[model samples]
Target: MANSKWSHTALLVIDMQNDFILDDGLMRVDGGKAIVPNVIKTVERARQHGILVIWCDGGIYGEIFWLKVVREHDPQGRDVELFRRHLYSQGKVGPTSKGSPGAELVDGLVIKESDYKLVKTRFSAFFATHLHSFLQTAGIHSLVIAGVQTPNCIRQTVFDAVALDYQPVTVIVDATAAATPDIHLANIFDMRNVGVATLTLQEWCEADA
Candidate 1:
């Protein structure tokens, strides 16, 4: 597939890290495991369509992508959110700490060489990051998102995408999830209200644009 057709589109895969999606995660997203296959499927479809795949994760270290490893917390978790600081408290390295196994992408999802890796310290991938400049430089204006825990990472990212004027932001409904179906649906509802497009993986893959 010639990438020219999708040159302006990018698929942002967020927070597929082991700590957030796997059975042994430190703070797993309740329904994250079930969507792993769908996320993989979405990545394959994105590649076939020639869309730039951007892998995203939250951390204080290295640039990453499927997701990358952060360097490690300050042992005291000062870099982490106040509520989540407990995760790294008491000298614990905490989940998704740099070089930690939990920061790795869940099994079955991979980040290809051509994909871009981005690390953020907060929920929105664009927050205090070069994501906006990178997207602008890449000439990307449309986004397709797939990932874990819709209410937080996914929702905040989508909202930020809209705020930044990324037209036609789309979320592959089945490829991303939350703690429960009701929570997922409610968040999806709010996104729709703000003009985000919510579709299934199949729907997104088949669309001409």
Candidate 2:
């Protein structure tokens, strides 16, 4: 297939920040680290296929925490969600808070100069954000998603993408995770029922090769 086959597609890497995926992270997902390699591989494949890479990261993407990692908030936690505000309270550092250690993307998943980074403050990247507008302007109609914690951020984003009529909303199964295998698989089943194309990293990366 020609490289332009994916010209209208974008690979959305969501909430792979340190705090949500690392071993000692503030709110670690037990299955996060295991999926790191697959997620990294997915990005490399996307680039090889000339697909647009957009990093949808921040402190809020995963359960509204990872999506907001890319967006830093006031020191007093003024803009943080009600539940996570305490992480920034009393001089404590919150996970994925801008300028905080946990807010950074984990090693090996660097955002390249050619890639775009989006900051979201909710479970869905499209909610309260210009992601939809940007995608439309970029002429992107298909989205391939990868990230941590499937039930919250991944599912919500996928659903909104469907609602917005983004065709072929693909999710890399091995590239996304949750606290447990059962949770992850169950959510994947739900997403599949909604017409999502859930495939493994290898299946997606090698399909066009």
> Per-residue CA lDDT of candidate 1, range 29-106, in tens?
888999999988987776666676777731111111122312234446777778888778677878778778888888
- lDDT score of residue 158 within candidate 2: 95
Please provide, for model 2 over 127-185, each residue's C-alpha lDDT reduced to its tens digit, 9 standing for 90 to 100: 88888887787677888889877998889999999999999999999999999999999
Ten consecutive residues with minimal summed lDDT in candidate 2? 58-67
- C-alpha lDDT of all candidate models, in order: 0.77, 0.77
**Residue 75 of model 1, lDDT score:** 46
- lDDT assessment of candidate 2: 0.77
Residue 185 miss distance in model 2 (angstroms) = 0.5
RMSD of each: 4.2, 5.2
Count: clashes, candidate 2: 17
